[model samples]
Target: MKRERDHQFECGICGAEDRYLLHNVRHRTPSYRRLCTNCLLKDHRGLFCPFCFSVYEEPLPIDRSMCNKCPSISHKPCIPSNYPHHTPFICPSCSSPNFSFFNPTTNGDSPSGRIIDRDSARALVAAAKIAAVSMTKAAAMAKVEAEKRVKEATYAKKRAREALERLAYLAAKEKEIMEGKGGGSNYNGLYLAPPPPPPPQITGKVEK
Candidate 1:
C-alpha cells in the first residue's frame, strides 16, 4: 500500500502551517496577505452582514444594502416589511433618514403601485422638462452657427475664383502687349513701311 505524504505550506499573514490557503483563485486576489480560512475571514470583517452577523463563503447573490446617512451595511431581506416605504429607510444606529432599500417592489395601493411622494414626482418632471428645453435651444444655436460658417466659407471660395479670373485676364493682356499685337490688331506695332521702297533701283545707269 502506498502512503500519501502531507505537504504543509505556511500562511503569509498568520504564519500558520496549512495544506491549503484560503483565497479566490478565479477572481481578483485580495490585497491582504495570504492567510488561513479563519484569519482571512477575520481580516475582512466588513463582509459580514449587519443584520445576520454572518460572513458569506462563496460568491453568493447576497442582497447587500447601505445606509445613505451612515456607513452601516445590512442585508436587504433582513429589514422588516413594516418599514416605511414612502420615506427613505433610516439606519438604526445613526437615526438619519437617508438610507434606501434596493429593488423595491410595487404594492397595490396607487395606480402605478410604486410608492412615491407627489412633491418628489413633480420635481423630477419639472427638471426633465427644463433639461429638454435647454437641449433644444442648444441644438438650434449650434445649427445656426454651422450654417453661418458654411455661408462664410462659400463666399470666400467665390471671391477666390473671381480674383483668379481677373489675374488671368490681366496676364493675357500683358502677353498681347509684349508680342506687339496691342488692342487685338494683327499688324505688328514694331513693323516699319519698308523704307519707302528704295527708289526703284536704276535699270541700267539712268536714262542719259
Candidate 2:
C-alpha cells in the first residue's frame, strides 16, 4: 500500500497557511483542489471554507462552462460539498449565488410565489446604479458649497482689513490737524469771518 503524501498551499484570499491542499491525483498526475485564507472576504462567488477562507481568491474558469471557483487554476473543484452554508453568501463582483445559502429565500410572500423576471432584475440593477450616481453628485455638490463658503469668508476678511486701514489713515490725519501741525487749511476763503466795531460807549457819554 502506498502512503498518501499531502501537499498543502496557502489560501490566495486571506493568506491562511495550509488551508488548501492538493487532491484528486490519478496515475501521478497532480490535480490541485483547495481553499485558502483570503477567500472568506468575498461574497458568495469567491468565498471559501473556514479553514481556507484566508487564502482563497475569486474562482476562475478552468475549462468550457467549468470554473474552479477559487483564485488559482486547479484541476479540481475548490468549493467543498458543504458550500453556500458559509458566511459572506454572495459575490461582491458579479452578485452571483454562492454555496453558502441556508434556508435560502427563493420566493415572495404570495402563495403562488413571486418569480424574478428579467425585466424586474434589470430594473433593480439600473435603480441601484442610478442611486449610486445620485449619491456621488450630492457629495460633489457639498464640496462645491463648502469651497464657496470658504471663498466668501476670505473675501470678507480682506474687506475688513482694508476698511480698518482706511480708518487708521483718517484718524492720523485728524490728529495732525488738531495739533496745528497740518500746514494750513486748504479752504482759503471758504470760511472767512469779518471784524465788528463798537460806537455805543461814545454815544452814551455825550448824552449824559
Error of 2 at 156 (Å): 1.2
Residue 79 displacement (Å), model 1: 37
- Among these predictions, the greatest TM-score belongs to 2
Worst 10 residues of 2 by lDDT: 20-29
lDDT of 1 at 167: 100
Highest-lDDT candidate: 1
Give per-residue CA lDDT, model 2, range 1-208, as digits (tens): 1222222454333334442221111111122223321132222223222222222334633431112344322223444456443243322222344422111135877564544455334333333333344356566666897999999999999999999999999878766764564243445323223345766664435543
lDDT of 1 by residue, 63-112 (tens): 76665654545678876677544245444434523422112247798665
What TM-score do all the candidates reach, one by one?
Answer: 0.33, 0.33
lDDT of each: 0.48, 0.39
Q: Report lDDT (Cα) of residue 52, candidate 2.
A: 26
